[model samples]
Target: MLDAVLLILREVLEAALILSLLLALSQKLHLQFRWSLIAVTIGTIGSWLLAHYAYEIADAMDGTGQELLNAALYSVVILSVIALGLFICPLAFKSHLENNLTQKKIFASPSGKKLIYRLCIVIVSFSLAREASEIWIYLSAFTHDTEMLSSALIGSAIGAGIGMSLGASTYYAFTFMQKSYFIPVFLAIITLLAGGLSMQIAKQLMQIGWLDSATPLWDSTFLVDEHSWVGELLYALIGYDSRPAPIQGIFYLLTITPVVSACAWHAWQLRVKTHE
Candidate 1:
């Protein structure tokens, strides 16, 4: 039951974090909540449909279909997050861009602003869809055991409460930060999430023998089982892994390094231009 609680909490929190961040950004731009609410409704319906077809989906591609579907989701999530960062990063530090031609932030033009708003809807939709699918699958596993089902229901309620509280906390925290700090911090979080998704996609691929998942770099299962409450929370927040494969670790680091370095370089260049 503890395992179920932690797992559900992690999945719920993942979506919540994405929605909370997007909601905070939208509030700043005066974007209507209707669009976001519509997205929430659509995602909930879509995920339920997908969950209903889970057995057929899992049976596809010689029983590797589930992994493939997960990989595809990671791809969607990866793209949406990166695009969201591109749109938000500039607006967060508009003063940093100097030239009139280049100074037009994503939200400067009507079309561009609409594009950002739409992407916000998409990112939220995809994030929720991904998490909802997992939660549905996880809960469905306890249908046979009445005791487990009762325990799971209790666990889920508590898990959801914790997850939502964390997401809300993150939103409020961002609201209190200075713009200079906010942009970089926001970008960093987005980048980290993207990298984590990439690693997860790789893990899914490995399940089908498409990529090497030969050995763990180091085992931390002794320290904290990922099924534990704290470990599961860390997994959602920062991509923690107890028995990370070398391939996953390598690619995860590779995925994050370039984005972080590039963003840092651009911020530095902006600082230099400001001085000049």
Candidate 2:
């Protein structure tokens, strides 16, 4: 039962937080979130497909197929996130880009709006598919154990409720924040999430011996027990790990550096223009 609760909570919170952020972003932009329905439907189907083929996939590519596929999928997500970040960066720091009419038109144009919506849909669908398939696979294992299955179902429900509540609270908090802080805060959250995901990709590659493993830089379990509720929340929110390898940090930095560099460059450009 405890296992069920933790697993469900982790997956639910991860997806819920991401979806909530996307919805909040849409609302902030004065755009409709109707596309979420389509994303959910597609994601549901994807979850079933991925779960159904789990064994076959694991058996392929010299038993490294699962790792390879996960790495590929994660790469897609990270790239999509970077693209989204680039798109939003100008708007977030518009005080600097205000004189650049092209940047302004990018937000106002219908094509730009479509691109944003499409990116959000892609992120949500992939995230949901990846997360929900794990739950499906786990729950499917207890089909023969009626008693255990019942307990698991109850635990899952409780976990889901808690996760949804937390996610909603996060969304409301974003909504309540002053407009000046919203975009920057959103960017920071996404950056942390993306970096954490890149760390996961590093782990996945290392599992297949594609990426060399390194000793953990430090143990943080004393500060935040990875198995505890707070740990779980942080894991879902920022991909927190109690013992993180140096290689993982490298992967994280590599993934986030582009976005950070671009933002810095934009800020410098803005400073120069201001001085002019």
Candidate 3:
């Protein structure tokens, strides 16, 4: 139950942060508020539909078929996490689209409204795609048990609601707080979370034989089993695994360290540029 709650919190927070950033960008650009809200609504609905389909597919498999399905789901989770970590990090730091949108004065025209609506639709589709991909991966992990499924679904819904509210509040707070200071801090938190998730994905892939080399770099399984509260907390926050394979360890270091360093450097450059 605690694990389920933690999962929901992390995933929901990630989605909320992404949506909030996009919404904030829209506001900065002086985009039509109604159209933006409509886009978000469409995106949320589309994500829920995709998650439902994933759950249905998982429910229909059994025995060896179930094993195969789980493997596939794990693969999807790893791939999606990698893709999102790569794509979102750069965008968070160096999004020029928002700046371009802000510069446009034609939004006051009738054709501009039409263009904005079309743009909003595209944004909605893209956002939904990202969210759906993540949600599907998450659902795939625990779709086997009836009780777990129920808990995950209910917890995810509640978490998403709370996260969205928190995100909105944070955005409003930052409006008065100085975006120059807030942006890096926000990006740092996200980078850490993504880095941790990436490590977990690498570990999962190695465990399921989807990846090569299954030797543990250091067997810490003796210290607080992952089911324990301390272990679970570490796992949720920092991707802590007691018995991680060598390849998993290598992948974690290779993938997360470089990406996080690059992100930090990029954010620094952006800050310098903003000041200049």
Which structure among the candidates has the greatest lDDT?
2
lDDT of 3 by residue, 1-276 (tens): 545555555555555554555455446445556766676676667666656665564456432333344344334433443343443344457555653343353454667546545544544444444445566678677778888888888877776666667678866765554444554554454445445555665654554456775567787778767666567555644557787767666656654565577677777988998899
Query: Which digits, one per residue and each the tens of the lDDT, describe model 2 over residues 1-276?
Result: 888989999999998998888888787767788978888898889988989999998999999988888787778778888888888776666664363454558767889989988988888888888889899999999999999999999999988888889889988988888645777788888888899899999899999998888889899999999889899989999999898889999989998888788788888887887789
Give the runs in model 1 whose Cα sits over 4 Å from its true position.
91-105, 144-147, 271-275
Q: How does candidate 1 score on lDDT?
A: 0.77
- For candidate 1, the 10 contiguous residues with the lowest summed lDDT are 94-103
Which regions of candidate 2 deviate over 4 angstroms? 96-104
Per-prediction CA RMSD (Å): 2.8, 1.9, 7.7
Residue-level lDDT of model 1, residues 59-147, one tens digit each, is 99999998999888778867777776765554444454342234355446788867776777777787787789778888899899989
Q: After superposition, how far is residue 154 of candidate 2 from its true place, in Å?
A: 0.6
lDDT of each: 0.77, 0.86, 0.56
Residue 136 lDDT, candidate 1, scale 0-100? 87
The TM-score values for the models, in the order shown, are 0.87, 0.94, 0.49
